[model samples]
Target chain A: MIIQDEDQLTAAVLAETERAGDPRVREIVRALVRHLHDFAREVRLTEKEFDASLDIVTRLGRLTTPSHNEVRLMAGSLGLSTLVSLMNNGTEDSPTSANLLGPFWRQGSPRMDNGESIVRSPTEGPPLFFTGRIVDTEGNAVAGAEVDVWHASPAGLYENQDPEQAEWNLRGKFFSDAEGVFAFRSIKPSGYPIPTDGPVGDLLAALKRHPFRPAHLHALIYKPGYKTIASQLYSHDDPILETDAQFGVVQRLIGTYERHENEPAPDPDVTEPWYSLEFTFVVEPGEAWLPTPPVSAQRSH
Target chain B: MIIQDEDQLTAAVLAETERAGDPRVREIVRALVRHLHDFAREVRLTEKEFDASLDIVTRLGRLTTPSHNEVRLMAGSLGLSTLVSLMNNGTEDSPTSANLLGPFWRQGSPRMDNGESIVRSPTEGPPLFFTGRIVDTEGNAVAGAEVDVWHASPAGLYENQDPEQAEWNLRGKFFSDAEGVFAFRSIKPSGYPIPTDGPVGDLLAALKRHPFRPAHLHALIYKPGYKTIASQLYSHDDPILETDAQFGVVQRLIGTYERHENEPAPDPDVTEPWYSLEFTFVVEPGEAWLPTPPVSAQRSH
Candidate 1:
């Protein structure tokens, strides 16, 4: 058979389900065939163009890595990442909104005591004390919650991407104290452009869109019996927050960084001028915590 | 924006093209947006599912190598390889039909004189004599054309995958003599299954399809000022020829192998009876000849 028309060919491929031994396999194949056929029809796809698209996808697979998540980058730039975050965290009354975990997030950050500074580079940006509480929907504090926090330095480079920085500079793991209070000092993160050098960059350039992501701090909060929240706290004043390249901006996740000077505080070892931000994350009760495979896990594999 | 509808969101993405500096970039992005949007809509895709798909693609990139064309394998199984071949070599009238250069075919095979056998392993299978001529469109001999051929062993494994086989067993590069005639002895290839232990296999399994390709020998014929023909000669009797998993079989490329036994003029070196196949290929004029990249090239950076 020449397999001329794509629709007919797709239907033929799908029709094999009638003779399939596994029902689940048949169902998945049928759905895949339908979607593939529908896509071709909707786009009025030509054989040549369809083939070119496939070639590009094949190139994407060939270009992926632990440091370079080209496929995830493609998915993020295409709005698929945002769509996923919305669908998976659609609880109406959830304390916090979730977002893309991004392709960074290295493992084994220094675990520090509450109130300890995670910032190893004091000169990179303004010192900031981040204080937050993990609580339930009813406003009850949830102590002993683990908070995984990480962010790019003021120069817009993650420790993993910068040879000058230590292994986990400005990255740390902390637990909420007995009163559900968590405090960590770190340098303020600055807005940075997503890497635009690979195929993903080519895609963004082709789309004529900017690749800048607003300054934000990444947080993954975990408390027993409460849905873990994987989210970003965006600086309210950052311009890209309004037009995030990945469409990940949520109104509730925006906050302000307040500047404080000459405050006589607990430790004189602290820098004279510093900034601070106080926020609380409310958790919802659910079993839908889909933990991302740690960066180490993928590397180990 | 929440981006509830995939089509509308895709339209928004494509609209960014108005700001593109290059017209070609704008045009390509437009087409990509349409196809990608159509794919999502056709699948009634949820955000979470799309994210999962991105994860799969990201992993694919990290698993590539020069020797392993995992991305190409994925594309071939998805019917994209055929599409790409069609795009690059439009349906112009050519003496020989083109097929996908599957994920094998390494560089640097031993060059053989005309009529010399290519099979290094005598115990591999029943020996078969293969003869072919390289001719131009008018049927005149195109002497000095190089023909590269390789196939799986009788037990059905390529040299790259089977460690037991010598480096280039059943593989050779030959030059056509002054008469455009070339011949080699090798075992008849048997129908075999594609590798089914990876994601491609997962896709095939989900589609409720077997990953069998019909018995065939891969050939790359090249001469100056002519289009290189990357093709497969399929056995006419193979059961899966009609439904090759990669959709690569063509009627014109199928050949018949005839059994010859008890000939009085048998050569002293030959002990067992064998089969024989004689076929000729016609070439078309083109620019500098370049053989199609092996499927491995698709995965190699």
Candidate 2:
């Protein structure tokens, strides 16, 4: 029916949306309209404020490109990404910890041997040897699982964001060994700021919030029978872990990184400090799916 | 503080935002976060749905430019613009009946003398003679008030949207005569559909809602001591008045436009079928201000 008042207007919008071809789409639109209308009323949003919001949101879209996903960044900054991941993955109280997909993940990372380095350039900082295992809830090893790993360079820049780094400098894919183990090497990542030259930066500054995410390694594990888990392993000792700007860190996902100095390198080729990281992923029974990466490595200049 | 859970994360985000220099900005951000979190929880939003929302909202921004405002159009399509306008203006139960400041309202309309026509082109349609008065709460005429009038031509296109129409055709500015009266002549406006090639149009189709707004004349009044009102007068007999896509028509704002056949024109020069629209605007007490036009007429082709 045609709406004649504010309340009726909202209802009509929702009612008409019920005819959507997809049931899920219908449900989502209904919720969005209801929540949005309630928000306007709850705040008595003024015209000026509404206009300001439209301007900021529009800028967010304009700033986004194949190499930049401002929408994803905003979602993470607002905690919605974390909330959605947590809610869908496991029970809120004790689900396997998951983190943001972030804007740096790329599709079709080059497959590498178990001990090969994902590092393709002469990067600075301590060498990091990372190892992990994927298993079902029963603790049995899930052999032949695809593990996609990526992280920033020591200087806090992703390969895509830094012109000095080689293509896919710190990105690689590995297959778990028979015992459900996967291992790779790279330079340890350091805490770094999100891109702040755009609208998100303005919001962070205005909110007085630091734009830094704690140093962490990203892993997307996939197996035919287990639910794919897009996860991050945070450096437990990093100063910003507890205050990650993306709100992506969970206590369960933080792991200790053992450091060794002046010791023989694991490969016996390096004469510098090195670190090792290890963790295990608990998978549930479901269809394995991969998230669309927020940004791709190849960007137009 | 370091966040350990969803609640803690939300609290930390809000805490960090308290540093905003402007209190109003702080309040708005706080409300925005709370409502956003609540909406996610209410819907148990999934990652796929979240991604879809990001795509649609991003398109809204990308589709916008200096001459076109897809964001404003979306806001109106959702009935948000009308809601905000009404809530901010007169009381909910008895508002002075404000409407949307649609994208077609160009600033600095050509000034015209009382009883002159806003029409500058050889347009073909029933001649429309419009008149209105501005009064205060005490019902006293508001002399010297400025009235800005604009409307689309019978072909359902504004001057900017149609090259056939001269620059500023069907747009004019006039001052209230000593008796608080203003008048002009132009072709009667026809009901029109909003631009449907963008995201807002996609939404209208998905929601199973029409995009047509009833034929109406826009007016922006300005007086030194009274609040400037941006309003629209809807044709009482228009079929779509009860179902304006923008939800902008109020019961009190609808008025009858009397049609005459071969009658003596209100202005002695006219000898054709014509229509006359008469209405009174009640200005509330407040500072006079003009809203920033959402889009400009001079666009880069």
Candidate 3:
């Protein structure tokens, strides 16, 4: 298999994959080599560009830490995460509520009673009383499901990514009641710029693209009989909802943030402009499990 | 720009590239996104598999250093390096004598006179006397060109990778004579395994592929009026030449390692057997420049 040109190079690389023991590995690797070679051929990629890409990839790995997963961030920024999520989840007719479980998920979220506040530490923002009703494709209630919820604070930093925030300040795990309803009180989450200190940031600046993700609250629901659904409910009014940096937005995932002014606040201490968000989560029947947390440690000062 | 499915995901991502201030960046990045999303869809890449890939990508960066370039190695292993080299080097007919400047290449090789051994320290193996003639497409001699030569010792480690070896062992820069000829003396290099303590190792193992590259000598020739050609001259008899791990071997680059017996050796320390290699390097007229070094620091004991 002496390679004489680009085609021969591609063929030779594909030929070697025939020796793989696993059929799935063979299939995936063959496709990868084909697409990878095709990319080089399509762009007629130069050695100089190839070299620079290697540096960027190297930087991706070097910059990743327990608090920041640069590799995953780059994938989301490229839209592969959303593509994979859409392709793998849901039926052909009914899309699954499944979405990307971004790098911010942390495990061991403290269990809280429905309607209790997940705000473990003092924080300032308009209050949000969010309610979710878990249902099946038939619109039947799926009760007793464990729903894990978390979101960024008003300052646009996850508890794990900001040291000033107390542990699990905006994170909680709530179990649905007999009516398949779960609710929690927290601050209204808003769009924020992704961390720009890494390679992905360089890419955003290079593309003249903003790094803002539309405001969203993340939830991971688990039950034994049904598939686990990891989803994000985007704020419909966020300016960048149409241009989410992570490409996590989907039409069905957008939740309305109904504003109420001069209305009775859920807590008497709360002032005006509090909000309410209600959405239904649909889960399919399949294997159910938890995802390994992507980010774990809090940022150090 | 709402991404409802995989195709929409791809379209949205590509559309964003339109905003890139640099046209070249837009083109390359758009093609990359299309191909990347296509790969995920073609494989229906699972969330678990996608997550695993991020870990692998992260390791590629974390393992890379001034001395070890795992990201580049992964690219070469996948044959992207060779495909790009073949594409940008020469026209369709007369293939350019260009090859991949593998991560092993370093800058500032010491200058040496014609026929001087690059073996700056004691090493084991059969001695080799190599000569290279520089020529244009018309077979005319190209004079006053500089030829940089380097190769691994029989132990399969470059000087920069082995602290036991003296400074710049098996590396030298030589000026071509007025006759367009440059010759050097060194050990007959042999095939060796690529470094396998990282992601590439996992890939090779997963594919049941061998990691050895055929024995070859590397040369980077530079002249003001000609394109700099980075090349690898393969031993015709090397078993793995047909299955190079880096996909670096080309038909024209294989050189016959003529053997001698009971003849006077080039050195006064006579030996019964020595090898000689003679090949002509053809460089087309174009810009000439040196590449940045990929590896530098020596391995610490």
Q: For each candidate, what's the DockQ?
A: 0.20, 0.56, 0.79
Instruction: Give the whole-model CA lDDT for all candidates, comma-separated.
Output: 0.69, 0.81, 0.87
Residue-level lDDT tens digits of model 1 in A44-129: 55544654665566667666654566777777776656554544564444434566687667655678998888877544677788
Compute the DockQ of candidate 2: 0.56
Error of 2 at B204 (Å): 0.7
For residue B53, give model 3's deviation from the true position in Å.
0.8
State which docking tier applies to candidate 1.
Answer: incorrect
lDDT of 3 by residue, A92-156 (tens): 57887888887677778899999999998888888999999999877889999999999999888
* Model 3, span B211-268: residue lDDT tens: 9999989999999989999999999999998788778898889999999899888886
List model 1 lDDT by residue over B173-273, tens digit each. 99998988888878888878877766777777765678888988988888888777777888877888767777666556787888767752134576677
lDDT head-to-head 2 vs 3, winner: 3
**How much does candidate 1 score in TM-score?**
0.71
TM-score of each: 0.71, 0.93, 0.95
Model 3, position A270: C-alpha lDDT score: 76
Candidate 2 lDDT over B123-214, as tens digits, reads: 88888888898887667888999899988888888888888888988899999987899988887888898888888888778766788889
TM-score for the B chain of model 2 = 0.91
- Name every residue pair that clashes in candidate 1: A61-B61, A83-B47, A84-B47
Ranking by DockQ: 3, 2, 1
